[model samples]
Target: MDSNDFAKFLSRISSTPLRVLDTSIPNSKYIYLDLSYDNSNLEKIDASSSESLSRFVNSHIKLHHALVAFGGYNEIRSIYQRSNHFNINQETERNVHLGIDLWCGTNTPIYAPIDARVHSFKNNKNHGDYGPTIILKHVIKDVLFYTLYGHLSMDSILNLKVGQFFKKGDCIARLGDSDVNGDYPPHLHFQIIKDIESYTGDYPGVCSKNDLDFYLKNCPDPNLILKLA
Candidate 1:
């Protein structure tokens, strides 16, 4: 199905709002992050380290949590530079992030938005990788889709099993510390996929400019359900 059709399908299924984070506190804010090449702020500090990133977020923004819009074509030079994982060759680099990232404290609760079955789970133990990742499959009105929760804590996937069921608003996992969560600050890399396409446990959350069309079509804007930023 096309993106418009997929979005409609998602809206139908998501009648109730999904609480990916704790909603108890007041004054909780969502700050939009700009990692695009033209943003001059990126040049001031290093984004690769958790400490530097945290300071950057806390210093500039008063919000408790930071929110990033999905499908943002970013120029995350520090993180993607000199890495074979992101830059395959001189011509192309996977700098455009495809997922909506929610930056918050470690051990924060993460919930399943709808009833879903665990499709796969794994610990991607690589630098700049999704430390503990889980993919859940959901079906609504004869349409199937998947949700990916990356950068999770090790404890979150300790007893997880394939085909495990989770009800809507279920606390399936918690945010991970920087050491285990791809060496980045604590955050949840949430994404929606119409088709997994042979990928299990992990998928490319970023793509090069040349392949932007394919990835954009494959991964719809996660904000259709998030509705935050």
Candidate 2:
């Protein structure tokens, strides 16, 4: 099915509420982060440094977490420049982010949105990569899909095994620190995939401008299930 049809299917099947964060906390705010190329705020801070990212989040009072819009074409030049995995070449870079990032603190609990089983898990130990990641396989109304939880702590995968199941709202994992989470600030990179193809614990959460159409088709807007942004 196409993106629109897939979205409609997801909406229809998502009868249960999914909480990736502690929304029960009063006075906590979710700030929308504009990392797109046109966002001038990107000029004020060092996008590559985790320390800089931490300070940016703390600047706002009671800001428990920050939210990034999915399918955003971000101007994350510094972070991607360090790794060939993202840079690809001097001409074409993977600057467009496909996942929705929920910027929060380390050890913040992440819950499963629906009944799912561990499809794959691995520590992607590389600069600008998803440090410790987990992919959960799920099926709803006979439509099989997968959800990726990136930038997770080492402990999150310690006891996990392929086919291990988790119910909705179960604490599946926790956010990792910058050092272990691909050297970036603590956050959960969540993505929804209609088909994983042959990828294992790793998948392209960002894509080059030339490959945007293909990636967009394979990975739809995560908000269809998240319903947060």
- Return the TM-score for candidate 2, rounded to 2 decimals: 0.89
Cα error, residue 83 of model 1, in Å, equals 3.3
Candidate 2 vs. truth: CA RMSD?
2.8
C-alpha RMSD (angstroms) for model 1: 2.7
Scored by lDDT, model 1 comes in at 0.77
Q: Which 10 consecutive residues of model 2 have the lowest summed lDDT? A: 66-75
Question: lDDT of each model, Cα atoms only?
Answer: 0.77, 0.78
Off by over 4 Å in 1: 25-28, 63-78
Question: Model 1 residue 6 lDDT?
Answer: 90
Worst 10 residues of 1 by lDDT: 66-75
Clashes of 1: 0
Model 1 residue pairs with clashes:
none
